[model samples]
Target: MSIPLVIFLFAWFVFLVIFTFLALVSVVQMLRFGVAGPGTYLSTVTFLAVTGLVLGGVGLYLAGVDWNATLDIALTPLL
Candidate 1:
């Protein structure tokens, strides 16, 4: 029932990779196939900015964490 805290970091990394792929594909589709308009660029910029802020916050939060820690999870039987 012991889990390493670094596992969370690993999970985040996986999520980041997936998010990056999806975002790239979305932006490509918008710019390549969608209509030409200001809203397209605006949406792209907003999406990137929001993503940056979110990842930056996550980085700042993780900065102070000690990855060497372990979490003990206990499960009780439910009858």
Candidate 2:
């Protein structure tokens, strides 16, 4: 089977969109309902920091990839 390498990039973009929506919802829920304390603020800050670091790292890694290509896979059947 063969598929365009760009398919993975499109999939990643979809995942990123969903992740961003969920992250926004989580922060809103946390702030709207959680007790007012340093713990709540700290947790939100930590979550945002980790999310930024991970996304930044992935961006750097993806910058070098050549998206104009295709991937081919071979499958063998055993019966």
Candidate 3:
């Protein structure tokens, strides 16, 4: 692979790993502490955690080779 592709893949992988880990941690924390904690703030935390996970997944799908057939082919020669 070309250097830019390699770099993009590496950066995306790292970003996904770190973001997923953080989202998971937040979800766990929300589950654990939410019930005993404040009502309004707990809901906000849950919302943020779920949103983070969903956005992270979308980013992964976009960055990974999942959509390669259409876009990848066009970009392959450039790479």
lDDT of 1 by residue, 5-61 (tens): 899789989988998999999989989987788898899899989989988998898
> How do the residues 1-79 of candidate 3 rate in per-residue lDDT, one tens digit apiece?
2243455666877987898788778767777666665784768677887777887887787766633333344446752
lDDT score for candidate 2 against the true structure: 0.93
On TM-score, the stronger of 1 and 3 is: 1
Q: Candidate 3, TM-score vs. the true structure?
A: 0.45
User: Each candidate's root-mean-square deviation in Å?
Assistant: 2.9, 3.0, 6.6
Q: What is the C-alpha local distance difference test score of candidate 1?
A: 0.89
Better of 2 and 3 by lDDT: 2
Clashes of 3: 0
lDDT of 2 by residue, 21-47 (tens): 999999999999999999999999999
| Superposition error at 48 for model 2 (Å) | 0.9
Which predicted model would earn the best lDDT? 2
- TM-score against native, each model: 0.85, 0.85, 0.45
Query: How high is the CA lDDT of each candidate model?
Result: 0.89, 0.93, 0.67
Q: Could you arrange the candidates by lDDT from highest to lowest? A: 2, 1, 3
